[model samples]
Every structure is written in C-alpha cells, then in structure tokens.
Target chain A: MTVSVPHSLDDAVRLLGEHPDAMLLAGGTDAMVEINDGHRRPNAMVIALNRVPDLRSWRHDPVSGTVTIGAGVTYTELMQEPLAELLPALAEASRTVGSPQIRNAGTLGGNLGTCSPAGDGLPVLSALDAEIRIVSSSGERTISVHDLMVGVKQTSLLPGELIAEIDLKVRAGWQGYAKVGVRNAMVIAVASACLAVDSEQRRVSIALGSVGPTVLRCADAEQQLSNAVDWTSGAVSPDAIREFGTLVSAASTPITDHRSTAEYRSHAVGVLGARLARRAFATSEGAAG
Target chain B: MSNQFFTLRVNGADHEIADSWLGESLLDVLRDRAGLMGSKGACTQGECGSCSVMVDDSLVCSCLVMAATAVDQEIVTIEGVAPIGAPSDVQQAFVDAGAVQCGFCTPGLIMAVHDLLDRTSEPTDTEIREELAGNVCRCTGYGRIIEAVQQVAVQRGGAK
Candidate 1:
C-alpha cells in the first residue's frame, strides 16, 4: 500500500489522472472509519488531500454573491467566524455534524464524496442550489448538487475526477437548517430539512434529507409557500404553512429502518418544514432568521 | 501493495514507523508501533472520543486519521500532555476532583478539556458541556468531570 500527499490541487489532479484507482482521502473522518471496521481496504494508492493548499481555502466573489469553498475545508472552519457569517445555514448544518473532533476533521467535500442522504451538509447545499466544481488533469467542469448525487453513496463523478470546490450563492432574506435525530449530539439525522428564502427573487426553496435516497427538493411546496407569502408584509398564513408542510411530507419516499420508521421520517420533515417556514416568513423583523 | 514506511512526529519527537499497513489508523500506530498507549481505542470509531489526539492544534479522533497520511503533521497524544514527570494542570484537576473512574476515557477527556479551555478561558457550564459532548464517560455521571473543568478554569485564573 502507498500514500501520496499532494501539496497542490494541480498535483493532486495530475496524480489522480495517473492513478485513477487511487482512493482520495480528505479528512479521513468517513474513510478511516470504514477502514477500521474492515469494510474497506486500500489496494494500491491513497491520495491524501489535506496537504493541498488549493483544496483547503475558500473565496468569495462580491459581484456574484457566491462563496466558493475548497474541497478540503473542514467543518470546524465552516462553523467559524467569516465563513459562518457568509453561509449561516451551512454553518448551522456543520455544527450538527458528528462531534467537535469529527467537525475538526470532516470536510464538505467528504460529505459530497459520501453523498449520504442523512449527510447534514446535503440539505443545505440542495436548498441553496449549490454547484460542485470538479477537476481533472484534462480540465475542470461544474455540476449542480442535485445532479452530482445520483443515489445512495453514489455520485456521477467519473474516476480520476476530484471535487475541487463548492459554489453557493448568497441569497436575500432568511435561511436556516434543522434535523431530527435520536439525541442532540453526535447523532445521525433521522430526518433533516433546510429552508432558504430569496426575497429578491420572491422564491422559497426547501430540501429534505434522510427521508429519501438523495436529498430531495420540495418544489411544489416551495412554490405554494412562496406564492402565499406577502412579500410587502413578509407574512405567511398558518394555513399556508400547514399546507406547505403536508406537501413537503408528501414528497418524501422514506422506508422503515432501524433508526426510524418511514412514517416518523415523513412526519418529522413536515414539522421541520413548517417550523422553518414560520421562521423564514415571520412578520416581526427579529423573529425571522 | 506492501507495508508503507513513514516518519510520524509525535510530541516533538519524530518516530520512524516501518512495515506498517496502509490502512493502519494513527491510534493504531501510536499504540502499537510507537509504544504510546496513552490514547485508548474504545469504539475504534469516531463515535467515542477515547482516541482523541491533537493533530496540529486540531482535536480529532486519532482512530479516524490514517497513520500514513499523518506523516508530516504534529501529533500530540495523552502521554505528551504534561512535562517530564508532572501531570498537567488539567490532569491534576481530574485527579483532585476524583473524575477518574476506570480511567479509560480520562485521557480523551483531558485532551478535550485542554482544547476547550485554550479556546475559551472562561467557558460557561453550558459551553463546557457542549464542547465536551464528544468525550463520553459512562462512570461518575459526568458531575465530577464537570466540576473538575470548573476547578481548572478557576485555577487557570480564567474564572472568578
């Protein structure tokens, strides 16, 4: 077995191009667990990405109102000051991921790499309509978060391609994330939801996790709630919120699992959606997040 | 694939590890190869903080870190927390507060407490609980552990 620690994004991609079968290691939070549990083994080469500087930094485009986060940026960094202020919903999701130790080592790119439906970062990425930047020796290309995740633990990324950065647009109005788990800390989400309101576009976006194979967007629910909100007053009726929750629940195709029942997951997402809708469309200035 | 040879710098000393598996965890190498048994492996997963260590100022579960991938990084284990022969203030506080029960999870808790106090000198009870949530202790019901952290805060002059 061999391990190659590349110091730059170019070198990392080049190495990937040379060894398409090499397993990529970001923070090793998920991969190492699999290795420890005897579920996975490194056959030939392991590409460690933590040393790559380009994959560990983030940048903001003022004109585009977008934040591009490097693939190796840890969740702890995401929950900190500047990035947290820029992406509050992402920050909130980051806080709920694993523990502090896990957060210190886990990366958004790892979340995308695993592409689990229960991943805390997925709902936020989906709700924000984030784009994934992929790189290879040949060149770079972009894909939406929705398109990138094909199914459970599955992705459309071709071999020799590395996730370079995640691009999220900063939108107008409020955005927040919440998840229902068995316990408060270090618990995987049984059902999770993210809500983002773009007042400028007069649109509301909702995404659910752990209730389906992939993070699902509640398009009908979003449209119904968006149209129900009075942009001038920034108020939404309780009836609209209830209907929105029902619509969101109806969108989920959950299965009964040991962690939770499908009925519970579907119901929990509805409650989460309604709560988020209330918070987003609250009439009081300070009440809305 | 064969055993990978690498140098891991731990507690200011570089240890050359040879004939190690590529899938060996940092915790595995620290205990087996380097003979540093201070970091215990309870869950063998990140769910338990028994294998907590500081990798370049970041507290992470050593079991989740690939040993070969940590070659160039500075790794700090429980054995490196104090000076030559004396326990650190945090360790001593754990003893004075009687926070040791079975002593398996003590090392990880000590590392976590050090991290929390270093970041927030005068952390509140809620903050301390939240910060130490990762380090679980089935014994003592965590009352004495919380008391020890409060004691350390006062001893360190962070709290009145």
Candidate 2:
C-alpha cells in the first residue's frame, strides 16, 4: 500500500483530493485495530496526517469565549496543563481512554473519524456544543457535533474532506465526565456521561454515550435543570439533581450488548449524569464563594 | 504493495530498513527487521502493554503505531533501554523485588517505571499504580511489581 505523509494542512487536503479513497491515518489507534482484526480491509493508499503541523495547534479566543483545537491534538496533550484548564471534561474523558499508550496515540479527530457511540471524547464534545470544521481542496464547511455524527460508526464527512479543527464554546463554570465499564481502565465504556454548566449563558448540557447509535443529548433535561437552578447562587438542590438524572435516563434508548444490559446501561448513565451534575454544581459553589 | 524506507533512532542509534511494508507496525519492524527481540508482541492489539516503547519520548504501544508514520521518530525499546550489557536501575529493581516471573511483561513494566521515575523523583503508591496500569503481568499479582517500582523510586532520589 502507498502512504502520503503530508507535512502541511494544504498538502493533506490535496492528497485527500487526489486519493479520496485513501484511508485517513492520524494516530491509528482505532484504524489499526480494525485492520488487525480484519474488520476493515487495507486500502491501497493512506493519507497520513501526523506530519501536518497546523492540525496540532489550539487557540483560545477570549473575546468569543471559544477554543479552537486542531483535529490532530492527541489526548495526552489535552491531559497536560493549560489545555486541561480550558476543557476539564475533555481532560477527564481523555484520562479514561485506554492506557497512557492509547492516550498518547489517540486524538479527538480520531474519535470523530470513528464516530463510535462508545467513544469517550464525543460525549464531552456534544456536552460542550462543539462545532467541527471540515476542509478539503474544494473549500471548508462548519457543522455542529450533533449534525456531523449521523449514527454509530458513521459521519457526514465526504470522501475528499477531513476534519480540520473543533471549535468549542468555552464558558465559565464546571464540567465533568464519568464512564462505567467492566474494568477500571483500558476498557470501552458501557455507559458514559458528560455534564457542563455554562454559568454565563445559564445553560446546562448533558450528553450520554455508549447508550445509542450516536451520542445522545438531554436537551429537555438540560432545559429543566438550567431553569430550575440559579447558577449565581451556586447551589443545586438534591431533588433537582435526582430529577435531572431521571430525565436523562428517560431520554436515552440503550441497547443490550455483551458488555452490559440495556437496563443496566440506562441506569449507569443516569447515575453518572447525576454524579457529574452534582460535582459541577459543587464546583460552581466553589467558584462563587 | 509498495515498501517504504524508514529510519528509527533507538537509544541514540539510528537503524534504517529498506522496502519495509507501510502497513507493518513499529513493533513488527523493530522485532522482525531490526532484529530487536526485547519488546514482546504478546498482544498484537494494544490491549496488552508487552509491545510498549517510547516514541519521541512519549510512552506508546508500538503495535498501534504504523511503521511508515514512525520514520525519523526516536524509539526506545527494551533492547535500547538495557542494551544487553547495561541493565538500568528499573530492571535491577525488578530483579531485586522478584517482579519477573515469566519475564514476558518485564520490558513494558520497566519502560513504564522508567517513565514514571523520569517524571517524578518520589511517586506515591497510587501514582505508581496509575503509571503501571497498562503493563499487565499474569504470573506476579502486581504486588511485587508495585514493590519493585517503589524500591526503584526510593533509590532514584526518591520518586515523587
């Protein structure tokens, strides 16, 4: 097989334009496993983006309250300081990903590329209401994480297009990620939940993974919690948190797999959602006082 | 299929192989082409850390890295870490703590401990457990491995 190691973002786009069928290789954490398991056939060509420099940079815009992260940034980098300070939920999710070896090789872009409901990063992205920037030799387009992910292991990405960067609305407040699996680590999530409270916008968002075909958002639950709690007060009642968990549990339609039963996954996600929400609320209290 | 020319620098020594398969993993090329038998490929998948190595100073599962993508990258495998003659402190600690039973997972565990001590002079028991979470040993119930890491950490100016 032939491989194109593009050093520049433009070169990567051009290579993908030329060989649209070439498999896109970032960290190869997921793709290599598929190839090794014979679940995916090796393509004739691969567009290796590890050499691309621009895809590894991240920028924070204070005015817009946005953080643009290049698709190539590995989870290891996210776990480090400065970046971790910006996206605590993403950092928490990154820590849950496989082992240190896996985190070193896995990228948020790779997570998007796989588009798996079990992906730990997607729930955080969904909770943050992140926007994805897709680019090609033709042009560029921006889409929300909800619109970009169509289904399990599926995305709306065209053949010649690749994820350029992810734009997150970084807000003041607290966010947390929680996952339940058979093992403590190096295991796929049986159920995952991410909760982010934007005190500035008075918005509370929760996303659940490993419970549906795509990362499921609890918009109704979010609206209820957002309206029910006063962020400035920084205190959320126990009844409110319990109701939020119940609403989130009602929103998700999980499936039974060898790892966990549908009923168990639903219950776990609800517990995780409630736990994270409570932590976020406590963090708000810390910030307020 | 076409083969690519790849260069891997391990332990400050550069090794080049001609006509290496682009699809081959760094683990495969390291053991088969470079004849470095130190890193064991117990799980060709990334589940097991037996094939762990340091690439560009970051610890990674070599089996998950594409051989072509690893060109010009610095790799430190078990062979480079010990070099057959000079065993590192981490290895000595393992021997002292009786951490090696079958010895299949030693290289990965040593790499993990080496990484841990490099970052922290005195690591707590919890920190050591978190660091060595990837490398698994079936023969030893990890009590000895944790002890060996603690012993090494204590020796290395105390691993914080």
Q: What is the TM-score of chain B alone in each candidate?
A: 0.95, 0.92
* Model 1 lDDT, residue A172, Cα: 77
Q: Give lDDT: candidate 2, residue A265.
A: 93
| Model 2 iRMS | 2.3
Provide the global lDDT of candidate 2 against the true structure.
Answer: 0.87
Mind giving the per-residue lDDT tens digits that candidate 1 earns over B1-160?
2336889999999999988887899999999999999999999889889999999999999999999888778899988899857999899999999999999999999999999999998889888888988998988888999999999999889544
Worst 10-residue lDDT window for candidate 2 chain B reads B1-10
Q: List the global CA lDDT of all models.
A: 0.92, 0.87
Q: Taking the tens digit of each residue's C-alpha lDDT, what string does model 1 give over A64-156?
A: 999999989999999998899989999999999998999999999999998989999999999999999999999999999989999999999
RMSD (Cα, Å) for all candidates, in order, is 2.1, 2.8
Per-prediction TM-score: 0.97, 0.95
lDDT of 2 by residue, B58-138 (tens): 899988888777767788888777656678988988888999999999988888788888888788888887777788889
Candidate 2 CAPRI classification by DockQ = medium
**Model 1 CA lDDT for position B125:** 88
